[model samples]
Target: MATLLLIEDDLMVRATLRQILERAGHVVIEADHGGEGLSKLEQQHIDLMITDIIMPEKEGIETIIEARRRHPQLPIMAISGGGRTRNMDFLEVARQAGADSTMAKPLRAQQLVDEIDQLLRA
Candidate 1:
């Protein structure tokens, strides 16, 4: 079991992810955007983070960068469905920004759980 911070802009996605992580036996802290995620990072002792790329106020890449800077040891997982036009894959950018792992949206539940376990174990 681990404490995970999930930063996502879509309400439905956030709720779904929360359910998934919780079902996997992890405690999840939800954030509507990267700004809120950063604040939560300061307030909570998070074992891992799962963030979306596109968001209001602040983007996941920015969050990843700052989080890495402040908490270099903290593991981060970045997820994205791509840009609205489907031209850009922001997940790569997130990896460059310091995400420990990246997964595309419409993610498979088992893959997510596996990745979380891998990151936490590392």
Candidate 2:
């Protein structure tokens, strides 16, 4: 099983994702926001990262960029439910930044597992 990093600001979302990933047999490390996520990344050996965009402290796109610099081969999956204004497509921006994949929220747990499996295999 891969050690996956999950960075999301919403408590419910984070909990739900953790459950799903755990059920799929992944060892998930949680972070409430991008800054904390970055700290976790520095402290451990992460095989993959699943992050939400529009988060507090340090947005996901910025996290992806910085994490890429630190671990260039680390696979990242950027997820977003849009922003407050509903005008920003942050997922696209995340791709431009360095995310290996992007998914919209409310994520389908099976698809999420499949994607993670694919990333880990790659």
> lDDT values of the candidates?
0.93, 0.93
lDDT for each residue of candidate 2 in 1-122, tens digit (9 for 90 to 100): 99999999999999999999999999999999999999999999999999999988998989999999999999999999897776448888999999999998878989999999998889
Instruction: Give the worst 10-residue stretch by lDDT in candidate 2.
Output: 83-92
TM-score per prediction, in order, is: 0.97, 0.96
Error of 2 at 113 (Å): 0.5
**Per-residue accuracy of model 1 over 32-116 as CA lDDT, tens digit each:** 9999999999998999999999999998889999999999999999999885866346887898899999999889999999999
**Native-to-model Cα distance after best TM-score fit, residue 75 in candidate 2, in Å:** 0.4
Q: What is the lDDT of residue 122 in candidate 2?
A: 93
Indicate the residue-level lDDT of 99 in model 2: 94
lDDT of 1 at 16: 94
